[model samples]
Target: MATGWLCHELYMWHNTGNWAQVFPPGLTVQPGTHAENPETKRRFRNLVEVSGLLNHLVQISPRPATPDEIARVHTREHIAHIKALSDAGGGDASWLTPLGAGSYEIALLAAGGAIAAGEGVVSGEVTNAYALIRPPGHHAQPNLAMGFCLFSNAAVAIRHLQARLGVGRVATVDWDVHHGNGTQAIFYEDPTVLTISLHQENLYPPNSGSISENGTGRGLGFNLNIPLPPGSGAAAYRAAFERVVIPALHRFKPELIVVPSGFDASGVDPLGRMMLSSGAYRELTHLLLSAARELCGGRILMTHEGGYSEMYVPYCGVAVLEELSGVKTHVDDPWQPLMMAWGGQDLQPHQSLVIDKVAALVARIS
Candidate 1:
């Protein structure tokens, strides 16, 4: 089995219009650009192609998810609202989340790419797959679209797997710097899916992703949140995965594993303050791959979530694809050394304290 890479150029065309543009034209913000531009994702694809890894993977076509498939995770009102906005020439659907004309169709394709990738993995068509979709989905809620996300791509894909393929007990691990509020909300009361998010504390959507916000009702012991303090580096993240994520996955023993992979946690991301490096992403992917192999026969699907550093995101993505495909390239990340040399690259005592605190939450829920 080979890894599958899913992408389409239309995803890049789903424009976010323009942001505030630096508050006052050409002053404070220095002419603001769209936070959710296509360069980061497009560059990631280019890097994959340039590295030759794209040739080694299965290329999956991007399809539009059926309305029924999407409705399983999103409200009809929300879907209709998005479509109407697109028909009316586009506008902001929620806070900071913009939509362009025909964005509705592009969003469908993004979610569909995730579904296709998930299906490919669970059906033994691929050992693992990575869907490089756009309009990151972890921030999208059942009725609301925020944080540059439209529909809950990961949630929709997981629901599709359960309904269409009869897969059970999915584990979604989100390492997206920001809390996966939408995902956490969707499965907050459903015990079949275990939602785990590792993000920066008190960041994005402020006050979300708290450790105490574990699942409720039947899902009480199924949800877990690991909010690392800002400035956390490679060591801090590794510790969180080893202590919290790995242990939880082992205990859950999910039939399939899904990751909302995000690159914004890297040191250079403008929207994030963490200190992850490209190699750090590679190591995280390695850990997840190992866990998937052990607990689920290597049935894993990763959907792209967030990453804003246009220059660095490509390298980070390349590192992840390399691990997923078990391939190496002559092109190396020249910025890795500099990023790793930053102050927070090594784990600090305080960072460990935070991880320990979050890791301890698992026991209560377990």
Candidate 2:
């Protein structure tokens, strides 16, 4: 039986006050209406309200990740720049990412939740944990913040383990629709960590996660990219995991597993064209948990990444939690009609050939 740990900050500190409609340059914020929360943070927090997940895992209280911890992965100059922006009453520093008055504290808690979850796994407190953090962290790099991400949560946790705890070998598997360019950039030169990204090609960062751009120097063959074509579903993901991620984990023999979980791959989500259903998350969770159990005594922690659809993200997250904690709260989906409206037929050979090509590409990446 696997123990489950959760960071309790899911409902706390999410878009408390109303945000202004007008954003700074290059900032694309959801139009603020009096009726809607309008902030993605608030929308993402809907997962906490799902009774199924709220009752499954134990919520461990988390404190803010200290400045030293933040500096482990991020440049000190970049940290100072973010603080300066927040201190000057919030501004957009390119890439549609906004910083409000409480941005610093919220971002700290997000990072802290991730670190605490990692600590839980490292100390044998839990076999696997899920950190339901916000201001999703995978897109934030060493110096640039983008795609609604602030601090690089997964990178900070990995670096903390490396610098302080002396846990050298870690594996970061990013399952977001967009590539984890920030994490790849941070560990591209180091051999201590292996980064695998499964995302849409040419989606967010524009030509970022190509299979050719593996890694340089000592990190060669340590980075793997599987850019599933748009509209690839469970067939593609399951095939990728069986043929790619599983073999990579077996070869790398990581000390722990870190997942940047993103639900935007759901078919109804606006972020990507993938057609995965809620059940796919459960299978993915089970597969990773199996890997952790077989390799690292089930030491795994997943940090929330990017999932923008308010209606579907919560359900997708709840499904993963249900599978992880072994708790079935059995809350039926009220929006199945909405899903039925757009849920197309199963991924066909038109899809299988693409998946076959992806499998061959993944085989070469390994």
List, residue by residue over 1-366, the lDDT tens digit for candidate 1: 599999999999997876752122335455457868899999999999988998999998879998888899899999999999988999889887888999999999999999999989988889899999988899999999988999999999999999989998999999989999999999999989999999999798778998888899999978888888899999999999999998889888899999999999999898899989899999999999899889999888999999989999999999998898898888789888888888767889998987888777677444
Scored by lDDT, the top model is 1
lDDT minimum window of 10 residues, candidate 1? 21-30
Q: Which is the leading candidate under TM-score? A: 1
For candidate 1, the TM-score is 0.96
Tens digits of lDDT, candidate 2, 282-306: 7888898889889898778889887
lDDT of 2 at 180: 90
Candidate 2: stretches off by over 4 Å: 1-53, 334-366
Q: State the TM-score for model 2.
A: 0.87
